[model samples]
Target: MRINMKPEEAKDILSDMRDQHLCFLESSENKDEWKKKYLKEAWACDSGAKALEKQIPCKPEEYVPDFPYNIFSTQKCAKCGTPVIGKKISKYCSECGQKIDWGEE
Candidate 1:
């Protein structure tokens, strides 16, 4: 079924569900094979949701760290202050699911 909701809201809901499933898996003593399988499937769905959450495009802002050397420069998400690491930042921010635009060097 189709659901109408903002990307942030949907991501929060999915994150909550994933956290709940993790709590269940950790706290429950039920070693039942069926339940374990079910949780595994839910985990897979959550993984997919993570990719889907990167719907908001945001450009990364370059910054220089306090380190003595300027080589310590890096980029952070403009929307969320999450650091983006790598020779080239990925298409989306891993922390807040903001689509990243590295722009032209």
Candidate 2:
């Protein structure tokens, strides 16, 4: 089964489920059936998320991992202010064809 959701949204859902599980444990209720059900669902979601994170790439050479790590290193062009990703040592603006001083020399 596939769920349509962004990685961040999915991660948030997983976190909420984990908290619910913890709450169940603290309440000392009979959660055997619920545990059997939701635990498997949570595991499925978590595994699916991990698989997608590996499959979905984050540009030029970066493979972003979940939510927080999903952000890639980007630099703005000094001449055009266009954000460039996965390029830290660049000395030229790919957008406007202008020479960039990236302080690498």
Give the winner by TM-score: 1
TM-score of each: 0.49, 0.36
lDDT of 2 by residue, 1-104 (tens): 98687755665666677667555645556567876776666677666555444332232322334457546665665445666555655544566544444443
CA-only RMSD, every prediction = 6.7, 14.2
Local accuracy of candidate 1 as per-residue lDDT tens digits, 1-105? 987987778777777787777776775676778568759866975986776666755578875566676564578878788878663647877788778866664
What lDDT does model 2 reach? 0.55
Worst lDDT run of 10 residues, candidate 1, spans 64-73
Error of 2 at 103 (Å): 21
Off by over 4 Å in 1: 1-3, 62-105
lDDT of each: 0.72, 0.55
